[model samples]
Target: MSPRNPMNARKQRIDDLAASSVVVDDAGTVDEAPGVSLIASAWRRLRRDPVFLLGAAITGLFILVAIIAPWIAPHDPDARLLIDQVSRQSNPIPGPQAGFPLGGDDRGRDLLSRLIVGSRQTLLVGVAATLLGLLGGLILGILAGAFGGAVDSFVMRAVDVMLSIPSLLLAVSIAALARQPSQWTVIIAIAVVQIPIFARLLRGSMLAQRSSDHVLAARALGVKRSAIIFRHMVPNSLGPVIVQSTLVLATSIIDAAALSFLGLGNPDDAKPEWGQMLGQAQQYIQDYPHLAIYPALCIVFVALGFTLMGESLREALDPKSRR
Candidate 1:
């Protein structure tokens, strides 16, 4: 009989340990458990997290409002309902009326209707940016992680350079460079800003997987490299990336609002957007700060929702959090 390779013996040992499964709890103690599925464990943890529940609720409500904006908005967002009450000098805006619970903006547009309807644009921009960014990152990250050496080094350097610039600054720069500043401009700029983040995240996760016992075992068993990467490594590396996407979704909304506020977003005042509304209110801010306050609050609460969910997801997915 041929003598066994020592490297093969080591791989087999590691493989056996991985198969038995090592579970770590918050106390930092590890225990052996067989047939433990990570997805099940993470889902169970998420179900019990109040933070995740709250985030989900807020996100769900935002989506609901966006979907039903047209039907639910009490007043026409584009109508100058209280124009008579608005005067740049004496009365910058109108106080809340019987129907207009939130009052009227400087332009005499119903603030409540604008707020309700604006959710659609916010949802569209945030979701579109996040999807595009995630797609771009997946392509770049996969190329770098699956093919190491020069490919990995080059990608990492670019990612590092992008990371050196603050996210909002990069987003602002990209948005400002647009020839025609619109919602699409906001979406694209935010997407571009997020690409390096997702790329670095995915690549780092994949790299960590390189030393995992399952990967080593797959190599020992002569599994095809492509299968080892896409089927095993990439899928496992997606947890953190998924969680990051939720957080990016929140950032995308804020960035969109900022771009609009800076006069780099949709130039049409007729279009109802939280950012645009906030920007228009700046001139009358001293006398009628409510215009800026409402939209700002909307942006803040919505962003907080996604952030909470993302943080909860991170905690739930961590191996140490398992019992």
Candidate 2:
């Protein structure tokens, strides 16, 4: 029989709106609640992206291979089988023969097994190198972004210097300086080259977010500098960096292969790697091109998987792409 208070009416309307908003469950299912977050929406978009699905399928396959290579491989990667067939004692570089689906290498090692087992090394180096660069870049970027002035200038200058040089050349130089060209050496080399890319990306992200509303609110509320940085600024800046890491992983894999192809990879060919296998096959390309083709194809497919995933994520996360 009486009119309601305007404030109470407004509150009721707000509650109704909130109740009608869509929320994303842990499993990514949408339900009626508060509005979905940007990340949740991005994830939904990614699931719908054919490109992302394709990439995920290929990436998952490679990851599966990396994890189960040893158990699934029919022979040890280093096992020399029927050398006479390879060394021309009995036959000339046999092609896809019995017990060797992909044929044997110059050393009579089964190409199929080596390729299978090599997935572990390739994925390991790619992931490790990307993480190494991501860690270094995060440290430098946060340091420079949170504490500008001399620190920022110095860090940016160093990054610029590194950027000026060709990334592969820098990696090659680092590998050359190492005591020996091993898997670790190749990882470190590629990681060093990747550092500047991530550093610059993160630094720019941080700087852009420094003036954002959340950051200003945190500062106004007297939040500790570290809390504002780690909880507010850095967290907000990570989406692009995370996407960039996937792309960097693809590059890292290629860089590792390049180093190995240049004869700067693992010293021992006994433990076969995709790059090392390709390298050894080079001299015999004219006689047995299959040896090189398979490894090269593996590298290409793996890289394509990462690239597609990264690009799809980028598109999904980009606000403009929603249109």
Candidate 3:
């Protein structure tokens, strides 16, 4: 046997694994280290990545706080425990005292408790909107990708029309036009704005995979057209879409907050959303900066966490990242 044959075999193996993740050991042997699907590989990468870890920590802590708010909050978020403190006389909005750390809002509610409880509303809105958009996008993207020509053209053109408008402006318009403003209005508006984005991304990804080897091989074999599409093409194409969903969660949160701030959020002040809290604090912002600062910081930090996780996931799932 020629020594070069072994080298050629090794080279062949390298080429085979090139499209996937490869690990080279000290012996110089190549192995498909993460012998798993794209999602499994991405999860492995996520576990080891500091950026993802930090983001996960922030995001997880937020979820935990939201879930346990009722148990951990020092006072009832809606109670006017400190209404006397803000009587517009001596102590106009008292600063942090015994029970009320971070002081009282103009409404005399415990600011700390409202901030804690508000996480539930924010998370609910963000998750709901993202899921809604993801569902709509999946349907449109599948139709366009699975059936090309007319369907593809029609869907793409419609998506193009949506893309032409600024996302925020579109959301604000939709939210503002609603007969009654509430969290559902914010959710619907945000979801509508997000649908086009997700649809376009999925369609592009599916199109790229349409001509790939696995798809062509399935066609060559006797796989049903629908089976080839859903079983192979759609699964393979979902990597980018999943990554985009994470990013959209952050965007949805921010969008929901924006609508809420613009008086388009839940009208029930008793619920105490972070965005509404921040909005209401504007008038008293001059004297009581903490009112605006706390909720604003919460929004920024949570958004940052999601954005970080999304970016890290994107990098992790990228085929180019395989080594």
The most accurate candidate by TM-score is 2
lDDT per residue, candidate 3, 52-164, as tens digits?
99998999999999899889988999998988778776667878999887988877889899999999999999999999999999999999988989999999999999989
TM-score: model 3 vs. ground truth: 0.87
- Give the poorly placed runs of model 3, Cα more than 4 Å off: 1-37, 321-323
Candidate 3's clash total is 0
Clashing pairs in 1: none
TM-score of each: 0.85, 0.88, 0.87
- Estimate, for each residue in 1-323, the C-alpha lDDT of model 2 and write its tens digit: 79889999999999998989566555565567878998898998889889999999999999999999999998887877857676455455766877788887777778899999999999999999999999999999998888889999999999999999999999999999988789999999999899988889899999998999999998999999999999989999999999999899999999999999999889887777888888888988886788899999999999999999999999888888663
Q: Where is model 1 more than 4 Å wrong at Cα?
A: 1-36, 220-222, 321-323
Q: How high is the CA lDDT of each candidate model?
A: 0.90, 0.89, 0.90
Candidate 2, 198: how far from true, in Å?
0.8
Worst 10 residues of 1 by lDDT: 21-30
Q: lDDT per residue, candidate 1, 170-241, as tens digits?
A: 988988887888888888999988999899889989989999999999999999999999989999999999
- For all predictions, the C-alpha RMSD in Å is 10.7, 8.8, 8.7
TM-score of 1: 0.85
RMSD of 3: 8.7
Q: Candidate 3's error at 152, in angstroms?
A: 0.9
